[model samples]
Target: MSGGRHSWITFVSKVIPSLSLSLFGQVCGISGCFNILVGCGVPMRSINSFALIGMALSTFFTTLRSFSTATLQLKASKAFFLGFTNSIVSAPMVFFDSTTVGRIFTHAYIYIYVYITHLHTPTHTHIYMYIYTHTHICIHIYIYMYMYVCVYIYIYIYIYMYTYIYIYICMYVYY
Candidate 1:
């Protein structure tokens, strides 16, 4: 189908590049850190700036890949569903007259679900497995964010308690 072909074109144009960039970023991040750790002249003196840059790039590219795949999946599903619906709607009255409403509805639903589910299954599996396996690569970022929030909360609570104690002491001494 033209829609399927178009979806593949979109996937190749968007997803493949995103996946490659994400892998490149990951390599960049790892190599930068390794270079710094091994005390390479340039990296040791430069404060390993590449590590941070690579991390940012990796995060961005990974997120892009995820979003692009999701978008592609939705677009393909919509295209297929719409095409099927259009054909059903534009069919001759004779075609519908012989088909019961329940049968038509059942066939429509089954076809949409079955076709979409079965389409490019191996490709979907590879994409999903990649996503699942690599998901943990971003855990450090999440951990850092969680630690930041925790620190903020701790500071707020400490300040609040200190202020409360200060007020209590002032009232006690002044009274």
Candidate 2:
């Protein structure tokens, strides 16, 4: 009887919490990614773009956050190298695709919120400082790149529209 009770207690304390955490992460990842992708013109049909983007963003942010925090706490040099590598690798994806940039920002915001709520120690005080600096730098870079892309696309579309309008006006004048 005691053994059975102990097993139940273990399950409740360990397994249930793990399962709940996994479920929460999954829900946040899926929904957050879906909303961002949908807002960015990715269709909800034929491809699970929502889940894929969501999971990618979630995993990317979570791993990055965890790595950054751990490195900061440990005062590791590898963190800087990792950050540089990440920026280089992710720059193209973000620059070419506005949707990916949106997803990344959204995921980062959500991850920060979740991280803050789960905080538990005074020793973790500097964690936010690290997060803030890293996030600030990343946000600036992404924003500049995204804006550049948007402006280029907008210019292209505007030129096309202007050309069409000019042609139409010329045809009307000729007639």
**Candidate closest to the true structure, highest lDDT:** 2
Per-residue CA lDDT of candidate 2, range 118-168, in tens? 666653454444444444455444434433433443444346445544643
* List of clashing residue pairs for candidate 1: none
Off by over 4 Å in 2: 39-175
Per residue, candidate 1 scores C-alpha lDDT tens digits across 32-132 of 34323333333333324564454344444434443444456545545764676688788888997889655775655555444434546532554433333
Q: How accurate is candidate 2 locally (lDDT)?
A: 0.50
Error of 2 at 13 (Å): 0.6
* C-alpha root-mean-square deviation, candidate 1: 16.9
Per-model TM-score on C-alpha atoms:
0.40, 0.25
Per-residue error for 27 in candidate 2, Å, reads 0.2
Clashes of each: 0, 0
